[model samples]
Target: MYRKIFIDDENAAHRELSIYRKGHVNAIRLNDEGYFVYQSLPISAHNYAALFHYNSIDALNALPFISETKNGLDSWDEAYLPNTLLEKLIGILGDELDAHRETKPEEIMLGWQDSPEKISYWRVISPTEFCSFLESLMAFVKEAQTTGYDLEFIL
Candidate 1:
């Protein structure tokens, strides 16, 4: 399972991008014309949020679904963060960003995956790559605020 980040403008235009992941494998499908079609990128929104110091994955996952008009609802197009929340997030992320810059990827383990056979796999993202992503996320949030778009998390 994965989560995709997208920006929808006032005109309902959507620009989607894949979240960064370790050892990513593209999942493709075939259309009627035998043309290969790829869906949105598969990256866990919880994991992505964890990278930003939002370690309440269980809490986030347990949030109740709201109507489409309500902001911060899961599986809805209304995940916009209000100005106050955005400001708080920015403040929190600023410190995290600086810390990430000084930390190396090898020094941090994002998480692990366990298979049925008891195999364990650890995933990590390079500091440079994570910094780039953090920069992009900050830019996206700012742009969303300026353009009246919502910062949505599709889990």
Candidate 2:
């Protein structure tokens, strides 16, 4: 079971993404169609805070919910990721994926994310799994773009 976040518009995915505190096994359901699976790494380092740059991740993390994930409260935090930012993220993540293909997962690391810390799952993530995560995110972003809606994380 999980708590949910809300939105003001109609086109947004309201209660799609699942957030599990025990692990990072997350999935997003686009508009009631189906589930998009993105598996987890060894440890739940940052728990997706390692996906974006400073401003974006910080904005998401700054939301009240992220701070209380461990409390198991009925609290909520905003998860509105705008399409404009996702546009840039797509290219950056794509480049990292390509680099990983050319080099090794350990070599490239999570070079896409800004300021990856020692607490991150950088050491345990595989190239295939990382690419899978990127692919799922790209699909979600593309769906949001097609619908002319900003991506909303149902955290």
Q: Which is the leading candidate under lDDT?
A: 1
lDDT of 2 at 115: 38
What is the Cα-based TM-score of model 1?
Answer: 0.47
Instruction: Give the winner by TM-score.
Output: 1
Q: Model 2 scores what on Cα lDDT?
A: 0.38
Give the C-alpha miss distance for residue 71 in model 2, angstroms.
21
Tens-digit lDDT track for model 1 on 1-155?
Answer: 32222222222222122322312112222123553323222334333534534333223333332335554433323232443355555555566577667765553333333433332222444566666666666665565445443343444
lDDT per residue for candidate 2 within 1-101, as digits (tens), equals: 12222221232342122321112322232343544433322213232422332123333343332222442112133233344555665665466556544
Root-mean-square deviation of candidate 2 = 14.8
Give the runs in model 1 whose Cα sits over 4 Å from its true position.
Answer: 1-80, 107-116
How do all models score by TM-score? 0.47, 0.38
| Cα-lDDT of candidate 1 | 0.41
